[model samples]
Target: MTQATHRPASWSVVATVRASAPVCNLFARHYLARGARQVFLFHDDASVACNVALHGVRNTVCQGRWWRRGRPDALEDRQVHNATKAKAWCETDWLLHCDVDELIWSAQDVGEVLGLIPDDVGGIVINTAEAVYAAPPSQHTMFRTPFFKFFFDERGRPRAYRAISQQAYGDLWNASKYGLWGHILGKSFIRAKADVGRMPLHHKKQERINGFLMRQQAPQLVLRHYDTLSPEMWKEKHLRRIRSEVSVPMAGRFRERQQALIAEAEARDGNAGLDQLYLRMSTLPPGILAECLTEGFVRVIRPEAHLLAQDHS
Candidate 1:
């Protein structure tokens, strides 16, 4: 058996979760195994301490009273806090800011992705695509109702949208401006360096343009977001966020949205529908869900493709 070789890269990963979730722990293990040198997990809730202890993973814990004057303002505070920690602790030349629910996959090995970064570039903008469900029943899995493409900026506000790609070579993000009503001012800037090259960060909606004050690149890599998986997990995460003293305005809005989604899912196929969505998802070919939601129709790289090739050979 060939041993997996770890390639040194300039980037590190940072994530923050208020209450502990099983999915978050799974993501941490996956990233750590994939060659991320450093991983930082931040939580303000003391209850999460017990959960973290069970995992036996060493992490930095930030304990304090968390409160938000309003919903929108509170969401931004969390972002700022995480960014502040990343700036303080991450020693890598580049930083990838992501949440536990978001998973970034590369067909090429990790080293291949790192090799693409140029020497002169400050940051890369990644394109994000929201995955949708095509009807049917499955067990344990939840499907995305085809609502809006991630690129459709007008459908949803930007703050709710998370970034899978963020570089932290020189100037780190200033967390104070996160979730502020105005434009993202002074938050997404990196120091210019001779080694930085033209790289793009892909979000579900827009591509960050290259050479401009803010550089964006649309790489072939994909970020699969499993935001609506498992009703129990979803409910637990949202309820915790909504109950938080800091999550006031946004929490209320989130609750409304959650209720609506639940109603819609139940009405569509009943409890059976939810069950089918989950079960079918466990068996569906890879990337099929994402393909259904893309604007221009693209071929999904299904797991069956590999199986078929082997069978033919």
Candidate 2:
């Protein structure tokens, strides 16, 4: 058995989460174990169970405190509000804003990696390795998936992911700005108290924002994003998206594309049709998964080894 190496630094993480108690606890545990100074989880839905579950965790802050007058209507608005407030409250050298489903993966301690960044660097972009499954696993077991793909982009273009997605979906696929199903531009760790105009849905990118400088991409760290794990989860997710009135800003055709897919699936065979579409898009076939692994389109990662002291534990 191997133990995580700790290089201590003042760094904290913040997220606006709505998840089960166990899920919330795991998020706190993983980051705390990975050497974050503290983990602030602002409950979007204010689940009492989740707050209670985190009680025993040292350096974990669980709260349902609304940022200001009341909760915002849009989910993205709530996220940005929570992240901004957490930044003000955090007494750390750096603060990371990411989702609960996204875990920081690094061979060296996270703080040690951040320590090397120069004072002039305002933030650092952590590249993402989106999780890919061979088969749909239960949501509880999704994080343990051994396969992940790091989409290669040349000058902000996802040529590699586009090629692979085209092979999978054929005529069904369309050219997307991002490589992955999730946010193509990964999350970031900003210097605490850095002057920023506003927080975007993800992070401020040089291409998208002016005067927001980011350091060269960190080599040792990658965000392991479990975008969708099971067909049931996928179905529930898209159904909510379709029904919701508040949509993401500048989302391009992504929202429209999802709504269309769900509608088509329902017309075909209701839930079963939706499940089939999800399976096809979310998980790779055995042959393609194997080929992607061999051809360097994707790579295998065992984060459990670092998080739990055992692979797939």
Candidate 3:
């Protein structure tokens, strides 16, 4: 019998976080369990608790005060700086830049996925699937669900957008042009040792040192973004933007919609307005979820919670 031979590739992940300790710990643990060689976490805040939570996790590095001269004004600028720093120091074959709320959902080992790509490809563009609430969520709910809205790359076929338009899903369809509340460009895995252009927010359309385009979009591995899993999360995220605590880009329809939502949220007292907007746009009723699944507008990706638990055990 001929034994199956798997090509060897080492990959790492990096994220700049300003979240709770548990959230930081889970983000590191999940990728480690998913076969990441190393996980680099740059805490945007000087939180001792978040750093301490990751201290014991094997093959993970947590850093604070990563900025040398001074911190950048925009959150995305900070992320790009940290990611570039990680790429310089990472010894792995590839380094991925992602957010703390995002997780890579892969059916196979991440390294194996990269190993299949041609050597000439300098970067890989992973698409995203935004998480959606299958049923009404409670106050404490946080990404504890299996439903996701997977929008395909419209570079070729416009099938995904056509399907969403056919739904006439009101606020849901009109939430963003790509039918996602978050970025449709997703995250990226840049070749660690390869000389490439400056890392942008999305990290797609990367050019090589020779000024040649070398970005390859791989739709197989999906970046599962838990942008807003519950009403509390939704409210707090928008509030941060409203208060100027977080920096969102000035351009794009997404930003315009976000500004409108922030204004609406501030107009109403308490969490009522945010809660209403969340229900109308983010959450999915049971019947609607089923119908979406049946029509192939949404997909059920039940990532294993035990994957991270096993590492902790």
Candidate 4:
């Protein structure tokens, strides 16, 4: 663990990537537009050549493992190393370690919300929400709409809730034993000067680092994880993860779920059955999103108020 000796003025976004160019570029654009000084992106060598080639902002790039190597933990370890390496190259006072789809939004400017974080704090533990769209975003997506954001108490403890379609699917599509798939809770922001080692997917190990972990009492900074935001994007993402193993710790269990899904698909009519499964997973959610809101799954929040896609209504 290393303690940061200096704090700079600008902030940066450090991301470990395995996503497409457009997705990666979009991620970089979102942060840069929000005042990120630089983006430190890490990807495998296969993508190294063209990575960050599309970003129009100040940015840096690093490389992760090119092979699927050992357990999913090994890949996570590699990503942690990449994040650490990116931090070394970063000159900013604070950096956000996030993924392409996970947009960290704030009603106030992100930097301003980040300012609420104390100088002595190591980082803030933020909660995540799987923003389910009424349909594909037509205009301003994230900024224009209120989502099924995570419910966090004043102390930052998460209130997990299943989606509206919770009863639509069986155990295969159910939330994992570990936690709800989209309502994940974890760290999003970290102090640059802290002596820390990256661990557990989105967060790093802060034991040796100085200061206590602070929680943002207000919903100023909520991570909008767009795992199912668009049909094409969702299909591509889940298909890739289904065809290959992911670095998430619960991947083995996930794989079992996938296998069960595959068995059911085959039982029904092979590829057609899988197609049926995908259709159900994607299509049934809009009704549920509405029902949940009406029935009060997560109350419509202020600033974080409701705004569905215009065309959907």
Candidate 5:
């Protein structure tokens, strides 16, 4: 239960991860190197195979108890549990809840971000943007084509519909509840010192919930999402998500576009069936791609675009 004494000036990132995937480890390494003081890895599955392969790093692994059937009411119960544990182990004032797939980038260092945050400010709201990509050409390791990018508006709202963009700020309370997406919302923030048991703001959400968090505006930071890393992963994850149910209402259009993409991919590389699916999904609406390139968040060098254009031509 030892905690580090060093607390930086700005916000401290509090990341909660399952720690089973290689991507999670890569995320930890990248953020730790970039000045993240503490990272909490909540091990939901206590089986021997579930623990991450991180060695000699500042992290706490909490082996979560098994749930025997009924749906758990709290979505981010694990995060709340881990955060409480972190608070007891290491006393800290601020927490930044983020996921492995999301990254916070800034021109200034971590300290600078923290410095901008005022002590009176209970929490800060950040925005997320989806990074899309087309399929890679033959023998290439990564996707090469540029697609349109989505942006979040000033009030921490996502322009495109994405559940992860909405978040909250507060300390542990008794009645706090986690939503379907594993985020806690609709709770009173405790202004004074209070014990965990006595706090009424515990996490508790009765029904499925999603959307934005209300808070003061702050400097812009990108929450780059790599949800669609590949076409195969895209189809698998998207189809499996709760949002997939929405597509059923729009089934005809979905099927038509899906078939056309499949045809295009097969035309390009039959063996690359997965790649074809990815290209179609990642293709941004015509003008959006150019807008993102002009903004410089996307790397659309002239030669690469020229080669892609030639191939299409």
Candidate 6:
């Protein structure tokens, strides 16, 4: 077995969690193992954050009735709050701004990935590959576990995944290559915090709020995002955001999709229809993962992860 090369102690990650507390810990653990020196997690559940071994900022940022109501603004509020705090807390040379479910994967230690940004650059936009999975091993298993990933973007056909129940592993496909929100890449890290006004939910810098634009998109560094991890998880998450801010004035494909999903699901078979939609979306498994390597849907983890070292499940 090969070990990862030594990494610089100049990187830290900042993440915010609403209900995915355990997964946040999983995120922290994986990043730390991957080379990030420190990880700060902000959440509403103090008890849940307490058990996780990282800089736990419990209830400090994620607290509010908005999350309970499912306000989209709540996500913005939590991210901005933690992004600022991370700027203050991060003594490292650079800080990673990403969500709990969006884990950035790199072939080399992340220090190498961050090095791609020239000294004049404030940040780098990392390409994202949505990690595809199958109907989770069970509800007991966490969302987007690496073991089940096989493809990215949209390959196969809708019928392929819908057919998983009958055929465990045949041809799971993805149809879309772009993100639901339109942009496929997102700014995941920033070395210059002084010019940053606030962390925007989707991208970095938030327009011209920052004086200079030193951010460039790096195709080599990729972020594995479980945005719509599963129908059950997606429903639970977005429903809260919808409920919290049905009138929050945000308009986009994400919001529109959530609205339609909530309405259609409720009117149809409760959440059953939504669950099936997700199950169909997540039809790829390890067998297809090998093929994805050839097609560029996913990349193999570089030194591989010590799966048994820290069990966040």
Q: Which stretches of candidate 2 lie above 4 Å from their native place?
A: 1-8, 47-49, 52-67, 153-158, 175-179, 197-200, 206-212, 245-247, 306-313
Error of 6 at 188 (Å): 2.3
**lDDT, candidate 6, 32-148, per-residue tens:** 777887777777445444446465322344556535745344445657666776778777777777777777776666787666454545556665555555444332243336632
Candidate 6 stretches greater than 4 Å from native? 1-9, 44-51, 55-73, 137-183, 192-194, 205-213, 245-251, 284-303, 307-310
Poorest stretch of ten by lDDT in candidate 6: 172-181
- Each candidate structure's TM-score, on Cα atoms with residue i matched to residue i, is 0.54, 0.83, 0.85, 0.71, 0.53, 0.70
Summarize candidate 2's per-residue lDDT along 95-141 as a digit string, tens digits: 88898889988888788888777555667788888888888877567
Candidate 4 Cα errors over 4 Å, as ranges:
1-9, 45-49, 53-73, 136-146, 149-173, 176-180, 204-208, 212-218, 229-236, 239-259, 266-271, 283-287, 298-313
- Tens-digit lDDT track of model 4 for 22-122: 55666676677667877877664354334555343433343233333532244556566666766777777677777766766666677766665556666
User: Which 10-residue window in model 3 sums to the lowest lDDT?
Assistant: 55-64
In candidate 4, which residue pairs clash? 2-195, 4-193
lDDT of 6 at 181: 24
Query: What is the C-alpha local distance difference test score of candidate 3?
Result: 0.69
| Root-mean-square deviation of every model | 12.6, 5.4, 4.4, 6.1, 12.4, 7.4
lDDT of 1 by residue, 156-232 (tens): 24433223111110111122112111112111222123223321122112222244233534254445454444545
lDDT of 2: 0.69
RMSD of candidate 4 to the truth, in angstroms, is 6.1
Q: List the candidate 1 regions with Cα displacement exceeding 4 Å.
A: 1-8, 19-21, 50-58, 65-73, 131-213, 239-313
lDDT of each: 0.41, 0.69, 0.69, 0.54, 0.40, 0.55
What order do candidates take by lDDT, descending? 2, 3, 6, 4, 1, 5
lDDT of 2 at 15: 81
Q: How does model 3 score by TM-score?
A: 0.85
- Count of residue pairs whose backbone atoms collide, per candidate: 43, 0, 0, 2, 15, 11
